[model samples]
Target: MAEWDIRKLQILRTLRDRGTVTATAEALHMTPSAVSQQLTNLSRQLGVELLQAHGRRVRLTDAARLVLRHAEAVFEQLERADAELAAHARGDAGEVRVGAFSTAVSALVVPAVTTLRNTHPAITVRVREAEAQEAYELLQAGEVDLALSLAAHAPTAADPRFTRVPLLADPLDVALPQDHPLASAEEPRLADLAAEPWIYGSSGPWSDITRAACEAAGFRPHQAHAAAGWTAILAMVEAGMGVALVPRMAAVPRDGVVMRELRADRPARHVVAAVRTGAGEGGAVGRVLEALRRAAGAPAHEPPLPGPARPPGCPVGG
Candidate 1:
């Protein structure tokens, strides 16, 4: 069939609705002969019988019925496009599809979304939680507009295809059971955790890093549970099934679980926002990125107040 036109599709739909040319013309404010001519033109273009008259009424051919269904959907899509365009023009609405890795979702994504709501309040933000690598792929495929990624270190600007924004460096921490021997040890070394059954997150960059940390400690960890995310790992730790090394920001202590610094020599990994070259700027995605930046820039921990000091010659405030 030749490419369809909006007017022809609308006329076919009107005929289907009004059941005849005369009634369709009355509804559309067009003459019956004009509507019939348009239908004939459409039938000629498609090389098919689109309609047939029966006594005082007209009905669609099977092919015409099928095409009309698709036409109805196309018109609905056009209407949606119009509504979305109007919303965009007014800056009152737009949809942003965002992807974030598991840890980032728990640690920063929620707060970031809250920040977005408080700041823009007009944009509709949809989030998909996935592993970092998967999320990156989704961003690359245009399935998502922005991805929250974790990098063990800063990324080199070798690829201009994406604009990488540094958000925060979230440090790693060791999760242990509440009463585990290592849990009570202040500044526990990585070696202290070696012999314990380790619960690792399912295979990923972070898992590699965790294993590397264990290998550096000179003992292979006993893999007890392989969980999906920090919460699962922590749940295992709380159940006293195994220990895990997790990002400090996302490894909040739960009942029966304890979190301590990793005390490793490696620098913290950065949680970053990755956007396709030209996709995320100056829209809902941009606003969301700003909100995430604000959340990631939040202080790691509250500083403690210092105790009062005594003068060199004075007795202590005793």
Candidate 2:
């Protein structure tokens, strides 16, 4: 059996095109001696005289020409392979796993997925609902390709292990019971509600945002109730248990809950899409990130409709 080295073949091809050892060496960034040594080794390996001297220049022999012809085909095939790989990386056809928190899933991820399905059907997106910490864990573990999280919970931009792409600054609005004194206020001042008992998330990013916003308004909230999910928190507000701060992304107009924009101390969560360092550039991940940015920027008059029926084993949440 005969063996051929692709690197050596490449050197030979360069030599044939350049028509001189010196020119070939210059083209390949090799010393002339090194280029000659490679050609000598390739000739010995192939058992053929691949070059012939013609005065001050060298030319490919008939045997060398035959091999070069085949080498050209091999080069073309390799180029085609590279192009296909790039297409796959660009999400032309492949799967992207995403992890996101619930509101982000409803606000950003689902709309991005729907857009991808329409625009790039060959790319499949699998989603899982996870909180900020859980989403980061899933991303680090390689369980998901992208994570949507509050920027406060995401790693800093200087972190070399991940790329954080900002999607939106989702403002926190005041959720008041319809009959509350300030419910109809065009722009209720946060400081004015400093004495109001507040409903807040029991823990996690939402709770952190709530506490921080209240503190910025010059007082710690009188946390009347702690609930985990937005639905429950909103329900509590609707029942007049207490007022609450709701992120714009999670706000839903309900019968008894009136949402009012804050006049001052307008706190907002920065939402960002995160990926493993270098993963978000020019691939399916990049495409999905773009879709998310578009979805986040567009007005959301209503929450996303329920996503298409889930296939068995499909994870849901964000």
Candidate 3:
């Protein structure tokens, strides 16, 4: 078998997924005719019927299917090689693609990226804000070098396919309007505002943390609103829409909102930095991981501490 171009493998993958030349063309940003021509050329090169016509549609032949299975693995290996080579050429000049959960992106990721830029200027960092499971899939697919993930509960098993590094354990903080009375309190408890309407961030580890904290305080919070993004939830809080319990990271900054530590015994969710097994051990990913370690404030020999309480412009206390 002749060596296949990575671009052809990508096209094959797209064809396998999109199932139509038109859809695959759109995905690959090429004209339909162009995609068809490439497929024809690829088939001729392989000397096999890679695709077959079924009515107006097309489908992969059995031989194509077998080729595709191996193609995927080969393409992945090629991608890693390309990434590693790029990392080498620039003298640590590779790129680190990272997927992060909402809160992690808002708080630790931004600052960590800032540090990464200052330290390793040659390395490129591509970040995607994603949910935990989505990030995990991206990591598994080799689409991203690291995934910043969170769980309301512990993960099922520490699988050998990846390495999980605990970055931070951020507690749930209460978000109140700046004028709210409890906003200034050194520490507040869910019991303090049992009757107030609340904004919730739907269901997640962060939301679960809030619910459990409130339940431990002896009342079910009146769920006034539910949203996915912290900014939306915080914006509602800013408008005095309702008080909300969010991860400490969400409370980090933004005008017109106040975040205070919850005195309740429930601890915060753990934020994890996951890599594709050995994917991030060196090169650009390693540099970014180092910055993440610094931004998250986890020193090698020292115990972790809660990150600085928000940035300067974003007031926390009332």
Candidate 4:
């Protein structure tokens, strides 16, 4: 079996197009003797005569013409491959796997996916709902390209493995029964609710936020009910079970629940997107991050909140 070198094949193709060894050498930045050596080597490797003297110059043989025809298709395919790779690198086409928490899926991930579909139709975003720590674990294990996390739960900037992109600081509002006394207050104080029973997530970053906020207000929250999902937590508050601190992004207007802004202790959960240090530089990951920033700026039904400051060198779509 004979082996073919692409460089040698390219030389033959150039010679065929150039018509003479001197012209081919000049076009390829090589000496005429070097061009002749490559042609001779190619002919010997394929066990065929590729060129012959045509009066004052050389001409490609029929065998060489046949090889050049096939080589033309190979060159075209290589060019197409380069174009596709460039498109992927630019985020014009490719897939990004994202892991997010449930609330983030509702508030940020879903909207980002919709925006990507409308703008970068060739980019596919796959999202999975996972808790903050779990999302980070997925990113570390290469199971996801990007992960949405609460800032308190994310790794420090010093961690070499990941780059954090701050998205928003979702302010915590007090969810109350429509008829509750605090519901009518222009701005409720967290200290006033010290005696009230609290509805909170069973465990996780939200639970930690609730505990810290209440402690800051001079009382430990009396956890009367525990629910993992925001819908359930808000439902409990709606039924007059207890008051709950709900992040602005997670607040969905329900029949009996009214969200009141906290005046004194306006605790907020900072949301951030994390990717492998260099992974978010461009391509699908970069596009997804941009969409997330846009989504974070526009919450479903709530008043628009100020977006987090963009990190240095971070690219946010216009």
Candidate 5:
């Protein structure tokens, strides 16, 4: 007869995932020595070697791989047990933690929280602002019940660990100094800005969006200025330093900048709500997801936002 500690298996799984004891310790909030100690204990419990030294790192042994495959089934059944309980629960009366990016907090999560207050008044929601990568990490560590993430940085659709729900397209619009020539066009083509100096983040998703859009338009951008904050980027555009692409949800009226839709192929960032696979079936998580969908579908003004709109007059910061 043998007994297995789920905690030790978790450590082993994390080591398999992260490739180093240090990284596994960091992810699990344990010391590297503690991680090694736990794995050594796991080896004794299972009566098999679980890891082999490989260069500076360790590699999972064949026995460890076999154990992991079975452990995954054990985890699935445990989640199903919780799901069965949740399916029969009557009230949604517990705190739910959410992690989201800054802009999504304002445009999506805020409105959803407001509605949850009125509709499911017993539900208390806690919100944390984090970009995509950090948010997913928090999700994996079980710190948040849900994460609002972007398509560019989310896990692949096939990833078995989390469930992805499409929330918004959040089309990209060109922010121009009000006096720019193409600001007057019905729909400006991205190609027309090939020669203009660009303003974007020094790194991260915004820079990726700007670069991908421009390169797709058949030219590379000349980044003359770098700013990560939307306010700073818009301010630079207002001061006429350079043009920048902004998400529709993040574009706000600032008096000297006009936001316009691009002509043919418009670039956009996709937003999604992610939760651990079976956890999405719980009453609180399910209710919150419905609220997010409603918030995302609401009109583009004020709280909650709309998709791309072709304005009669130039919209945004005019």
Candidate 6:
């Protein structure tokens, strides 16, 4: 009989990726000595020489590679077991920690929570505001049960660690001052606004998306001001500072800001819900996923509904 410490195996895997104990320690937020100690313990437990000194660096012994192969299998099985237990432990009633961008929290998560309140009243949803990239990190760290993220930044469909659920195709509309010239156009081509000043974040997915949309339209946006908040961006547009590409979910109806569609163009960000591999297949996570779909006006992906609540109308992400 043998006892295996999964944490030790994970450390070894990190070392394999980083190619050095110091690098692995940095990645895992541990001291290099601590990493060495853990691996030493693991080697003693398995009675194997997992590492061998190379020229000034260490290399994994053949035994280490073999252990890694089995370790991957063990990790997968553990994930599956976790999913099963998650489903079994919380059929429809449990706390679900959800991470999402601010806009998504308003437009999707809150509405879903309301729906779940009426349908699965016992389900408690704890919402954490996290952007697309950060949400993935939160989900990976097991700090969040579900993550609502922008599909543009979410991990690839082939990533085996997460199960992605497509939730919405949120279109972007050109936000301009109500008094701007193009404001009166029923639909303005993005090219028409090429000379206009633009409001965008200094750097981030929001900025990348806006710039990409502009480039696709054959002109670079003249970023006149940097603002990450939709509220700030829209306010700037209202004050005649600049214009911006505001996602439909985040384009709140401000009195001084008018949102206009770009003729013959639909630049949209895909919104998705992600869970740890198989966790979204059932249980509290599944119920929340279904509610989010309905909230986003998308068809429910799972048939876990007991009743329905009205979807709340609110602004959402970039």
TM-scores, in order shown? 0.59, 0.66, 0.62, 0.65, 0.88, 0.83
Which stretch of 10 consecutive residues in model 5 shows the poorest summed lDDT?
Answer: 309-318
Instruction: Report the C-alpha lDDT of model 4 over 1-318, residue by residue, as the tens digit.
Output: 766878998788767656788878876789999999998999999899999988988889999988777776676465445445656676478888899987789888999999989999988998888877788878865688888977666667444456677777777888999899988987689998999999987776667778888887889999999987778988898899999988777788999999888856767777788876556655666778888988988333232122234332212110
Root mean square deviation (Cα) for candidate 1: 17.8
- Residue-level lDDT of model 3, residues 64-135, one tens digit each, is 888777775665455456556766777777778899877677677788878767777777888898777778
lDDT of 6: 0.81
The local lDDT score (0 to 100) that residue 188 gets in candidate 2 is 81
User: Pick by TM-score: which candidate is best?
Assistant: 5
RMSD score of candidate 4 (Å): 19.0
For residue 36, model 1's alpha carbon misses the true position, in angstroms, by 41
Per-residue lDDT of 1-318 in model 5, one digit per residue for the tens?
667899999899889878899999999999999999999999999999999999998999999999988887776566666655765674676677999988899999999999999999888889999877888888878899888977665666445567777676787889999999998998789999999999998786677768878888899999999998889999999999999999888898989999998758667777877877766666787778888988989332222221222222211110
lDDT for model 4, please: 0.77
Better of 2 and 3 by TM-score: 2
Q: Which ranking of candidates, highest lDDT first?
A: 6, 5, 4, 2, 3, 1
> What lDDT tens digits, residue by residue, belong to model 1 across residues 1-318?
376878987788778756779888876789999999999999988788999888887899999988876775675466446545644785745677888876677667788778778777787778898766677667644578777876532223543335667666666677788999888886787787767888885576666767776776787877777876666778888999988777666666698988887655442566667775444445566667777777877442222111112111101000
Off by over 4 Å in 2: 1-91, 298-318
TM-score, structure 2 vs. true: 0.66
Ranking by TM-score: 5, 6, 2, 4, 3, 1
Residue 8 CA displacement from its true place in model 6, Å: 1.8
Clash tally, candidates in order = 0, 1, 1, 0, 3, 2
Instruction: Provide the lDDT at 12 for model 3.
Output: 72
Candidate that would win on lDDT: 6
**Candidate 1, TM-score vs. the true structure?**
0.59
